[model samples]
Target: MRQSDKKASFIELGKFLSQFSEKGNHLNPEVKNNDRFFDNFVSLIELSQSHNGWFTPEQVYFSVQSWAEALTESNLDQWLSRYDFTNITSKTVGLILAGNIPLVGFHDFLSVLISGHKVLVKTSSNDQKLLPFLAEYLISVTPEIASYITFTDGKLENFDAVIATGSNNTARYFEYYFKDKPSIIRKNRNSVAVLNGKETKEDLVNLGEDIFRYFGLGCRNVSKLFLPKDYDFKLFFEAMYEYGDIIHYEKYANNYDYNKAVFLMSRFELLDNEFMTLKEDTSYASPISSVFYEYYDSADTLKTRLEADKDQLQCIVSNAVITDSIPFGKTQHPELWDYADNVDTLDFLIKI
Candidate 1:
């Protein structure tokens, strides 16, 4: 497709998505009561107990909006102007998706599709509806692209390139298996935060949303913190307590209770509400646990420590208080150009 045609199609896709997402209030019913666009999503989530696919309709609404704006028409044009995409074109790309987080495959799928590639998608049984939903939606907006897409559950062979996301252990498997293929294999990562102690109660509360949303299953959830050395824990915990109801869900309660018990048995120190646990650690990527804050003297010190432990962080969340150069809050909703595992996805696509 020509640039103009691609642009037009993206615009239509955006408009369609915007319209669909506005009906967020109807999503639960559409899935549970009415059976509509999200019926497959409900079924997929139900089939996979390990996957945290119980995202609020409101989250889906905002997420679809974020993606539509970031991936389509003027946004793509602007992004291309900022980054070189001349070399990325129609290629056959294989994707091995991760199920640790919901909708983790969407970014790769969008990248391949937007780059004019024929995608061979291998869905994780843990999270399947997203890919199918996306393909269906894209076909609804641009039927021509449907022929270029294929779903696979087998090994990806004879593909020009591969993009895969998995745990560190699984990453090793991928490296050994697809050694000769051009690939971007994303390993495990977790996001953190730098608390200046100057944040308002509302800011802390918003940060709580970032940490607890998705029950902390997302890569973007703030698993650790760097606070001012003399910061007051009581005030911070008070703000977090406002969100106590978030922990009432069965899955979250199970994780909290199970992990809390394990920590007690292991003689580990824990910070707890009636709902969640805050323990100390370098990294955490699942809802099962979260790391606590250790005070730092200054931003520079925090930066140095973060650099020293850079491998442990996926992104750093602040109200842009430090710098806007890094990925922050809600790690799950990646933009089209956010690039997985800190690698330039488009550049990788171009080479293959």
Candidate 2:
């Protein structure tokens, strides 16, 4: 299939996704193949939590809507305009997707195909349903796309290159196993927010969205906060109050109770707001239901530190106070060009 064909198929898939939301699912008769796929898609979203407790309907709907906005014709064209696919040869790129959040690895899947390559996907068990369902929708829209996609339940073979997302431990295994083959092996990285004690209550409340979205499972979610020395917690906690309903989710509440009990038992000081806890720590990866915070004395020194530790971070959220920092709540709303791990996936694919 031509590149234009692939792009058009994705655009249709996006329109199909735009119909489903937290408010309700509306049937758009103009959307192609909706009569066959729409009802099943809704059923899958409702059944998502049964497969993975974290895949609640609200979270899944948010992810679906995010993709709906991303796969527009203009966005796809802008993202691909810089690449030259004239001399490309189709190679089967293997994808080992991570399922921490809904459609966490969809970008890689899109990159492989959109770059004039076939994709052999190994879906993460936690996210098997959603992507495959969408893949079916894409095939329905463009039958030729079927030849370009494959899913496997066993070991991956007959692939020229691979892109694998996993923990730091699995990264080592991927490096050793795929050493001879060109690959992009991703490791765990966390996002952090920098507060200069000058942010508005609205900014901090939006930061709550960055923290609570996907229950903080995504790499883009801000798991830690960098606050100025002696920064008051009064306003921060109050801003976070908007998301107090998050505690009502049984799984999140269980995590809150368990982690809080463990913290208390360890005699550690914590700033608790019933729904979430803030702890003083130097780590980037915080557990669910809690956020780790650290105090910095100087913006210059903190910038230097964060720059040196860039490899361990996914995003740095700020009000543009820090270099290359994303806005408060926009971490999860990454554009097509916001390459993960700061590695250009399309560049890697085209060269291979």
Candidate 3:
């Protein structure tokens, strides 16, 4: 397919989702009058926030678009002709889902289905609803895909590839269990940001979305901040605090209380207001104890330091100089070209 065709298809899908968003069909019902698919997704994600359950409706949406465009771009039928899909008619792929963040498994789910592989999905209880709902949606679009999709609570063997996501601890389990099979075993990773004083206030506000959206529970959330030493926290906090209404959510408040209590018990100092808290920490992932805001004496030094840790970072939300190849601003204003983990998952699917 031509790139233009690929983009058009994605925009079409985005329009469908936009319609869902507009009608508030995707929000949780108990929150008010929630819709079916998206509302269930949001609730599942909100639940996952407490248990660290993986899969959010938003992440699922992102993954869905990623796969949708990928299939469009690769022209699955044409690409599969090269691999001779007829020869692989009996393959079943097992996906071991993760609950670290919301809807991390949907990408693998899309990969399996779009590639004509029967998927035996072992969903994390934290995210049980949306994938099935999405599978049902796909079935509505093309029922043939339905016969290829199945959800299971138990383990299965003999698959072409196993796409398993878990913590570093369970990674060994995945490797040992799925030994001798093709697999993409993912472990924990976090995203970060580097700020140059030149960033506009408007950009900082959007960066606030990059950080505060989902209350910083997403893999794509900016868990850490790289700032010039002595930089004022006023603007950053102001923009972030604007989203303070999120604190009213009982789930977020619970997390804030647990995290804050832990910090107090540890004797960790924190800066705060009624809405949000801040602190300096070397860790990339925050515990809600406080936002981990780091400082560099200069932008050049910050850039160099980030380079050393580039492999460990997933999406860097930056407003400063970067290797021109790297897209800026959290890539949250995501385009079809942006794939998570900096890896083109669809490329893997077409090859598989």
Q: C-alpha displacement of 4 in model 2, angstroms?
A: 0.6
* Model 2, runs deviating above 4 Å: none
Q: C-alpha displacement of 302 in model 1, angstroms?
A: 2.4
What are the per-residue Cα lDDT tens digits for candidate 3 across 139-184? 5444455567788876765567778877678989989988888777
lDDT of 1 at 294: 66
lDDT of 2 by residue, 236-282 (tens): 99999999999999999999999999999999999998999999999
Location of the lowest summed lDDT over 10 successive residues in candidate 1: 25-34
Misplaced by over 4 Å in model 1 are: 20-62, 69-72, 83-89, 283-289, 319-321, 325-334
Q: List the global CA lDDT of all models.
A: 0.68, 0.95, 0.61
Model 1 over residues 142-212: C-alpha lDDT tens digits? 67877778988778866888998888899999998888888888887877788777778887877787787
Structural similarity to truth (TM-score) of each candidate: 0.84, 0.99, 0.76
Model 1, residue 99: distance off in Å is 2.3
Ten residues in a row with the worst lDDT in model 2? 320-329
Q: What lDDT is obtained when candidate 2 is compared to the true structure?
A: 0.95
What are the runs in model 3 whose C-alpha is more than 4 Å off? 1-16, 22-90, 100-102, 324-333, 350-352
* Higher-TM-score candidate of 2 and 3: 2
List CA RMSD, all candidates: 4.3, 0.7, 6.2
Ranking by lDDT: 2, 1, 3
